[model samples]
Target: MRLRGVKGSRNIEDRRRSGGGRGRAAGGIGGVGLIVVLAIGLFTGVDVTSLLEGADAPQTQSGQVSAQDEQAAQFTSSVLATTEQVWTKIFNEQLDRQYNPPVLVLYSGVTQSPCGGASGATGPFYCPADKKAYLDTSFFTTMSRQLGASGDFAAAYVIAHEVAHHVQNELGILPKVDQARRASSQNEANALTVRLELMADCLSGVWARNVQGLLERGDLEEALNAARMIGDDHLQRQAGRVPNPHTFTHGTSAQRARWFDTGYETGNVGRCDTFAAARL
Candidate 1:
C-alpha cells in the first residue's frame, strides 16, 4: 500500500464522543428480527434521510475520546478520499461523466443522518435520500473483536460498500430497485436485496482494483475474509441458527466473495450489473 503522501478526505463529519442519545429498537424484536433491522442498514446503506426525519438528537456532550480512535477517523477519511478520486477518474474516463462527492459522517452512539436519527447499531450506511455516508468508528473495534473482520482495508471496505450504493443511486438503479422491492413478494424482494448487496461488494472491489498501489499482499484477502465473515449465512450460523433462504439478505459467503472478485477482476462498472444475472 503506497499511500504515504496521499491526501486524506476532508469530507468527514466527526461526531464521536458525545452522542445525541441511544437508539431504541422499535419492538424489542428477537435476534433474527434485530439482525434484519441491522442488516437493512448495513446492506442498502443507512437511510439517513428517512431515519433522521423527526428523530430528536441533542448536541453531543463534551468529552475527550481516544486519540487512537481519532487516528482511525483520519484513516477512514483517507480511504474515502481515495475512493472519491478513483470513482471520479473512472467515471470520467470510462463513462464520460463526473462523479459527485458524497459526505461521510462519523458519529458515536447516535447522530442525525438525512435518512433518519442514526444510532451506532445501524452500523455504517449510506442514505440515498441524503447522499451522505454515516459511520461510527467504534464498529472497527467491534469488527476486529466480534466480527473477525479486522484491518484498515476491512474497515475501508465497509465505507466503500456504502459509497457503492451512492454510485448505484447516481446510476438511477436505486429508485427502480426500491420500487421493485415494494411491489415484489417478500421472497423475491429478499432476492433483489441479495443482488444489491452483492453489487455493492463488487463496487468495493472496483475501488480496490483502481487503488492497486494502496493495497498490500494480504490486504485483499483480509477484505475477502471480512466479506465472507459478514455474510448473512455466516452471521446466522454464528448466532447458532439455521440458515433460511427466505430470510437471507446479503447472499451466501461464496456469492459475496465471487461478486467482489468479479469487480476486482473486471474493474468495470458495467460488469457489475448483478441485477441482470440469471443467477447470482
Candidate 2:
C-alpha cells in the first residue's frame, strides 16, 4: 500500500509508555485471540471478560517511549486516516449516513479502558464504552515475530478491522449481538462469536475493496496473509498438533479466506453477514 502524503488522523491519543502491565485481574489472550475479540464484537457483541487481558507485565511509566515512538504514532494515524476515508464513503453509500470515526488510543504494555484494563500482550482492541481503539505499538513487532504476520498493510488490516468494530457499534449491531450472546449457551456463544469474527474479516475486505485503486500488487496478499497467519487454526498449529475446536475463538484458515474474499469481491456489507450464513 502506498501511504505517501496521506493525512494522519487527528483522533489519536498517545500513551505508549504504559507497558503491557499486568492488570488486577488478567485474562489470557494471544494476537489471534485479539483479532477474534475485535471481530466478534462487530457482529456478536464483545465479550467483556474475554476481551480484557494480556501476556506479560511491563512497567507503566515515563522513559519508556523513544524517538521512534513518534514514528509508530504517525504511521498508525496515517493508516487510520485511510480507513476513515474508505469507511466514510462506504457508510454514506451503503447505509446513507456519515461515518463517525472512533478515537485511536496508543498505550504501552497495559492501560485502563472503558471496557477494562488491557496489557500490550492482549494486542490492539476497541473499547465501545469509550468509543476508542486502543493499541500498543510494540505489537507491530509482535505481529511479525510472534504472530508470523508482517508488513505495514497487515498492521493496517488490524487497525481497519478494529475500526470495522466501531462501524458495527455505530449501527447498533454490537448491542443486539451482545444481548444474544448473553442469552446463549457456551457452545452457542462460541458459534456466534465465530460468525461475528468472520464478518469483521469480511468487513476488512470491504475496506480493501473501497481502496482498490490505492493498493499495490502485494497489498491484498499481505492482508490475506495476515488473516491466514492469525486464524485460530494457524495459532493452534503453532501451539501444537491436536488442536481443539471447542477452544477455538477465530475461525479456521479456510473460513478466514472465504469471508475476507466475500467482502472484497462484492464490496457490500450486506453480503458480509456471517450470522445468516450456514457455514462460518
Candidate 3:
C-alpha cells in the first residue's frame, strides 16, 4: 500500500475533465441496477449483455483535474505500473512470451469505449475489443461507503482483477469461453462465467504474490475482504433476496476467498487454473 515513491504508468488516458458527455441508450440502465451490476462485476464478472455490447457513441470533449482526482489518478497509475511489471515477468518466466500491457483508461462520470458508452453507473470494466480497462475512480469511494470494502489494497485488487480479464484475452481463454457461453444453457453459461471470474480473482492474487514484498500488514486481508464483499450470494442476500447457486455468475464468498488464497499461497499460475478444478 506504500505507493509514495513508485513510478506511475504512462499508458493512462485521463478523461476526467472531458466528461465524455455521452449517455447510455434510453432505458439502458438505472442507478439501482448499476449498483447491482457493479457489485457483480467487481469480482463476480459481469453479465453477457454488458460484456458483449457493441454500442459505440460519439464522444464530446475538455477540463482540469482537481487535487483529489489528481491524487487518485497517481495511485491508479502506480498500481497499473506494478501489474505491468508483475505480469511481464510472469509471461516471460512462465509462458515464454512477451506480455503486452493494456491501456488503463481513467474517466470521470462518463466515457466512450469500443464496447459501449459507460459511466460510473456501469462500473469498472475491461473492453476486450479495445484491450483497455476503463475505470471511474469514484468506485473506490462507493466500495468503501456502500459495499463495505475499503483500503488501497482493495482498490488495487479491483484494478488487478480487470487487468486479469485482459490477461485472459491474451491467453485466448476469453474467446474460447465466449464461444462456449454462446452455445451453453443459461445455467451452464453462468457456471462457466463463475469459473472465469474466479480465475481472475486468482490471477489478482498471483499479482499480489509477485508484489508481496511491497505489501504491508493487513494488505492480504484487505484483498480477501474485498473478494468476500462482492460474492454473488452475498450481494443477492444484501439485496434482500434468497441466494441461488444456479444463477450465480460468480462463485460464492468462500469460493472466491479460497481461490484468491490458492494463488496467493502458491504464487504459481499453473495452480490457479479454475477451469479444471471440477469443484469451483
Which candidate should be chosen as best, given lDDT against the real structure?
3
lDDT of the candidates, in the order given: 0.73, 0.72, 0.76
Q: Where does candidate 1 stray beyond 4 Å?
A: 21-62
Tens digits of per-residue lDDT, candidate 3, 1-280, equal 9887789998898877775543443332222211122223533333433332343222223455556667778889999999999999999999998999999998876777666566665668777778888887867776676677889999999999888888888998877887787799988888888888899889999999999878999999999998898888876676666888887876888898999998899888888789999887
- Give the candidates in order of lDDT, highest first: 3, 1, 2
Better of 1 and 2 by lDDT: 1
Q: Which pairs of residues have clashing backbones in candidate 3?
A: none
Candidate 1 per-residue lDDT, tens place, 1-280, comes to 4566888898877767653445552432122211232232233322323323343232234445567667778888888899899999988988898899788887766676545565555677777766777777767776776667878788878888888888888888777787787799988988887888888899889999999888887889887988897777776666666777787778788888888899999999888989898878
RMSD to true structure for each model, in Å: 6.3, 5.1, 6.1
lDDT of each residue in 37-98, candidate 2, tens digit only: 66322112223333232322233346366555567778889989988898898899888998
- Clash count, one per candidate: 16, 8, 0
For candidate 1, give the lDDT of residue 165.
81
